[model samples]
Target: LFSQVPLVEIDGIELTQTRAILSYLAAKYNLHGKDLKETFRIDMYADGTLDLMLMVALAVFKTPEEKEKSLALMVKKDKTQNFPIFEKILKEHGEDFLVGNKFSWADIQLLEAILMVEELDASVLSDFPLLKEFKTRINNIPTIKKFLHPGSHRKPPPDSHHVEYRF
Candidate 1:
């Protein structure tokens, strides 16, 4: 059984890998853009989202001191280096969603990554008003609210390597 997470079954077809499955569903459901190039752009943003998540994951696997050091390096990199790209994207889009001005998989992917960072340090996003607004708009949507409500379902128990800390 393909019980691994990110598994999706549609019309007797099984899908694996979060990004591949999401892109497929977006195309099938008409959630993606009208043009091929737009889809590529969305994929680019999604890739950036995955990169941020990977940075978060990197810290999770290290010893406590290493985790602290890693996170410190991550924060320094985030605060001084990369957030401007996201902030600029938000301003350029000038809408609730990232590309094509509608809710799409890129928005979902980035939002998920942002929330992960928030769990580490909510203040990080406060420095970027547009990003903060982007998060708020996504979070306040009726569908998103219902899907992510606190009581909806239990998250899996923390694994042995899980480390909880705050900045």
Candidate 2:
């Protein structure tokens, strides 16, 4: 299985940016959102998830000690600020998924975000009931469950390849 997964190519047009690719597929599959307002809301949450991912990505390639310290700070900001925003969104929406209650791209992104943070700290999500439930709910979806089964595709580690990386 290819690492750096989720690379989508359609009609010879290749997309590499994760959010853009996911959003494109979501739009194609009618999972983006039901309306314009909801689309913007989905974008906000999806971007939040992207920010979480970036925090981890930026830390990669650093010295181990530096990575550890930087990740710790990122976790602090996440737990204190970023996470509460989504938690409140879920609390306010009172729905199974984020945004307009439908299973949108943002829900998928949130599950990715949860998995990314859990990489930093296994118990990081313990305090966030909504996020924890959201992760479990997304995982239980039949198609998603199969996709997530062990030995499936995985995102490539940033430093695993020599690509002249930089922040």
In lDDT terms, which candidate is top?
A: 2
Candidate no. 2 TM-score: 0.84
Candidate 2: tens digits of C-alpha lDDT, residues 1-167:
23564578886787776777877788887887778999998888888778867878867667779978888987787788878888888899789998777898888878877777777779887778998888899999998898878887865546625336322
lDDT of 2 at 19: 70
TM values, all candidates: 0.78, 0.84
* Candidate 2: residue 99 Cα off by (Å): 1.3
In model 2, which range of ten residues has the least summed lDDT? 158-167
Instruction: For model 1, state the Cα shift of residue 77 in Å.
Output: 3.5
lDDT of 1 by residue, 1-167 (tens): 45555578896898988777877887886767668887788888888777766676666567768877876776666666656777888788687778888777788777777777666677888779998888889889787778778887524323343444321
Native-referenced Cα lDDT, model 2: 0.79
User: How far is 108's C-alpha from truth in model 1 (Å)?
Assistant: 0.7
